[model samples]
Target: MCSRYVGFILLVWFPGALHAQSAARHCPAPALVGGYFVPVKETYSHDFQLTYACENTYKPAVEGWWATSVCQDGTWSHTPQCIDEKGCFPPTIANGKYTHASDGWYEEESVIRITCDKGYEHKNNLATAKCANGTWSSLPTCEQSIKTCSMPPKVPHAVIVHQGYLELFPEDSKVHYECKDGYRMEGSDKNPIVCLAGTWTEYPTCSKVTVRGDHTSTERGTQPGSGGGGGSRPDSGHVSVEVGTGRGHSTSSGPGTQPGSGGYPSTSDTRPIMIPIKDCGTWPLVPNGVVVVQDRMFLKFTCNAFYTQVGPEDVVCYNDGSWSQIPICKDAFCVMVPGYYTYGLRLSENQFIKEGELTYIPCEWNDYSVAVRCTDRRITHTSCCRSYDHQWKRCSIVRENFLPVGSLIKK
Candidate 1:
């Protein structure tokens, strides 16, 4: 009858009993043993667990006491039993999240979303945070930035040189150019510069090289105009003279009708010849000016000196309309007859010549060339020009060129 009363109370509370014993150590509830561990502080799923009391007796769970009604309702028999619940310990994860990777293989990393700081920019790919061996890992990284620049272009009708070389930045750096001498620049008042991949922009230009040049000839017969007794000489009375010509005057004629008191021929029968004077053809062309005027002879002058039509070094048509002597640019400078200095280096207009610079006399330059000093104007394998300086006379001329001394005419 004692067990009957306990059985009645057990059935009323547990609804059923797994064991018919008056008390048992465990409930008959179904479970996967050793497969799962609830956290130390976690409770069994209430829906999956239950606590019960038999109407026959008062019982408590904390008192180390349990009633037969504690048996799993469906599995226990009509008899009551009591048992203690185990595996209610807390887990390592404190966030109340799940980490049930049933396969025993844990996720290597969680998808974590990341971001960069104020001045930095994102560098690596950012993902989201996910569940793993129970926690999260570090975030992605970020980096800084820089800038770059480009190269320059060329200009037109102007000559532009770096005055040095074309090199990358830190060497022949960025520089703009214009015409060397006579050219004028046309474009933006300001030059443009850029850096391409850290390189500089230095541009070059094209030059305008030209001059307005022309000539005309004036021929007037010798005649004494209304101007009393002094006038131009006639052609008939004049005798053509070529200085240094093996024999003085190349031609001769009768004396003029009215000979000037100076014992020179006059207008009535002599004619004044207007011969254009030029450099001995050995001098370089003047930089910005014409060397001499046309039809005006340089009858006399020293080498490389000032020229004034009336200067003592100059000679012009007299009142008798006849020149005193022959004229040439030789009077304006000490011209170095063009020739080779060394190694076939020929002379040019440049004032300074190096050992390797070329120097040669002017003439039809055949494949032929010879070695000589700076004063020889003859073109031959042995005669060369003197390449000297501004006045053109600084170089010394040789009196004995292949020919005997004074053999060649100073034409």
Candidate 2:
């Protein structure tokens, strides 16, 4: 069935018809034995030629199959047949995959789109390949796109873990930034800078760490240097600070030697203050139908399928390091009304109600019908009474379930 063996074939049995003309007067084009013919005509004159084409993913079995068939003296000179062309197999790529094509075949000049999996990136912009004459041309590969950050900048009185190495950093790399024995990060020791897009993020500053006998860190803004006992406070005159740029040197700024005065500590330079949930030593836990985004430092709520979100979508982190008001997820459908038989009850799944939808429920023993609608985040019920005379009257139900507006209902 391969198309490579395409050549002419001769038959010795039809020797007389090689030069003989047909007995019929009109030489309509004969039907092809195999494959299909193009430019179909209602009537064919003598010596008319018609072209034939094969189906998709197929080629002519013989070179003459691509040539025109002649209708001479009401007969075809030869019948054309088609065969399958050699196709390219699935390509092998690293860190990437090829998209599936229809019929699972790669024809000549077929372009295959390539995509890298998560945590990987395409090298250079060559994300595609073409099949040419049963061979793939210049197949591209996906390389590890992780970029490690260089060593962190030097900060006095602080101990950085996994420091300095040109090839150590990768995308989303995290490094521990803790202060030494008598020092702590400006705000907290757990705060670490992440590497993103081949660059290291901003790191926290180191300040003098004050520890009480109970092992709890003292609040920022407290002056350092203790006096009489382990629990005694430092003198108000001497301000504890770093001196001479060494890890072990400690000095105090005199009353006159404030900030801007010969490298003395400033009043603004104090211990790190605690932020709300960020200082809890762990990421905050989010409830169902919600997700936590560390980048914006907030919890975003999202409803499940067939449910509608009623509250805010974005909860942002404030400048004070505290989180803003978080929104809640709400159910989309209303609750089923009591003491009513609805039409097509068996067909419904009896799930949560959808907002802006109208449902009909008939009275169990009476002809009275009720129409319940979900709108404006609340459910409204309307009653239709079928009187003795067969007249219908619209009434309102006061004992119906009332869903409060702006209230979140978990599905």
Candidate 3:
């Protein structure tokens, strides 16, 4: 009787323990966009807390760089999202104030106008700051209204003609340059190099004279009479001239000595040989753009207004008949037309949306909206969603119609 009672109790307890173990829940590892979590694991037990941090130029969707979330009921309490920290902080100027006032961060590519305090003005007349990426392009500097240029740039094979020691040159100041011996000024000598608006105008260049060869020649000619009584007499015979760096001598015999009676070889005037300019052919054709020929050997690549140029802007045609580098014009921005709209966004004119951005276009006359993304100048529709009320709505549409969903748009 005692053994049977003990076995029954153990059986009941084992089953209860198994049931309790099976009741415990676990949450799968969370995937954080643009960020990562610490103490990574395949699964987390209920109520497990994990810390996460965002990458540079990205911020957590919640508040700060570092955030925490707890696993609960087979899921995370908070969804991890890291968004772009676009735009830059307000620029600080010592004696200038930005005219635009905003409580929040400024948008990318936004310009901020500045006004300097009394008795001061912005240096270089730059009174605006532009936001780019996540930083300000520049900060306007305010200073007393004084314009002076620093020491002029050093010209090759030339020196500044100054009387005394001088550090700064006032605006509208004139400076002259005298080329060194064996070198001559290439630019106009009548126009003096002047400093204007705290900057110097184009400076003259000193070009060295290139000499190929120098030669001096002397020639003597003699003629022999045909008859026995005829004697040799000096005749103006032509001499074939050979040019060389050093002195040269030429002699001519009368035509009778050659069995032919004729004057010496005719004098020929030295003429310079003309060489054709080396050409690499027409500028290379860039897709979606045109090439501007700066000169025969140099070219500048220009893309459409919304396109960006990849590779070097300026290219050179090599002597071997090839371009230094070929540039590609890629679509860089998405165009949003007028009358079409995104929810909560109003557009008075066309808007240029950047790449890697989400665009929501409301379906025609329907409350549903289509989500699209721009990649490499191509628009791809991802999903469709309906409004809460399902009422008719109009969303902003892309610039071009007839573009099938997910088709690449060629500019």
Candidate 4:
């Protein structure tokens, strides 16, 4: 009976103990020992799901499936592997191009240099762009260059000088401005506008000329109804005598003929005078010491009293009513004296002597003295004997050899 009882208890207890041990056997989680894993933790439980995402510029190694796995029993369903992402397409640019290419695919933070085409200018000389996460950064633009200027802006009462057949003004090209007739520039005469960096510089303006003194026109011929005997002579009598030409007269005699003195008509002749009106109008202001001589159709200017004439002196009045260029008078001054003199040479209160003025050199240093007069804008020296000295040797001095000496004569 004891043996039967002990055998029954051992049988029942041993089966129960084995059943409880088998129920306690559970899985911890899936282990990703082969490759990288998501939801990296020290421990995991059963039926745990993990979704995988690759790093920047990297993607799943496999194709056509979600990068995911789940823990079941004691192992994972799939292991995740990553590979480099595909590079961006070659960049396209307008008026520019990219350079410095590599053979392999571009990764994150990859840089590419850019360059503009010829004749095109950019803000930066060399430009660059970067790639990140399969996308490129913003690129710089390239446009047509602008280094020349068109016909410059016009100024009031001024004209721009067109240099031959040039249609456009290049950089640094100079453009000159000239004032028109009856007007003059207020600023400097040489003021000009220059092209700089595809733009024209500021241009100056022109101002009207203001005349000085009284304005009056001189009369040339006699009026029609003047009762004086100084009436205008006949066309053939005075016109030919003044102009030396007979091609401009039309003569017609009336039924009553009255002969005048000096072979001229005492009364008015009905014939029309066909004198070609050649008048240069009112004369411009003349300089000091200037003389104006006027003929029938011409005027001549001359300077007097140590003044020289500059520019055209003779002006002819054209039949179309225009005059030639006027002239100016310039003062004539003496050149500087070459030597330093202690005495004997004296000048008046005026430092500069005009032409045709007289200067004297005293006889304190020599028995002979000099009298100089300016002629033709030059000094003419003539030696005159102060007094004859027979005991002392007489010496003559030339104007060209005028210099200071320690002793005029050695005795």
Give the worst 10-residue stretch by lDDT in candidate 1.
279-288
Clashing pairs in 3: 237-264, 238-264, 238-265, 340-396, 341-395, 341-396
The residue ranges of model 4 lying beyond 4 angstroms of the native Cα positions read: 1-279, 286-289, 308-313, 319-322, 327-342, 351-369, 373-411
Q: Could you tell which candidate, 2 or 3, scores higher by TM-score?
A: 2
TM-score of 3: 0.23
lDDT of 4 by residue, 240-327 (tens): 2111112343232433333332222222433323221233233443442233555664567775433578888776543223345667
In candidate 2, which residue pairs clash?
27-74, 148-169, 148-170, 149-169, 332-353, 333-353, 333-354, 334-353
lDDT of 2 by residue, 285-371 (tens): 223233433442444555433345665765554222334556644445555533343332222322234577664443433334445
Off by over 4 Å in 1: 1-222, 225-312, 328-411
lDDT of each: 0.31, 0.49, 0.54, 0.47
Clashing pairs in 4: none
Provide the TM-score for each candidate, comma-separated: 0.16, 0.26, 0.23, 0.23
Backbone collision count in every prediction? 60, 8, 6, 0
Which 10 successive residues of model 3 have the least lDDT summed?
A: 219-228
Compare candidates 1 and 3 on TM-score and give the better one: 3
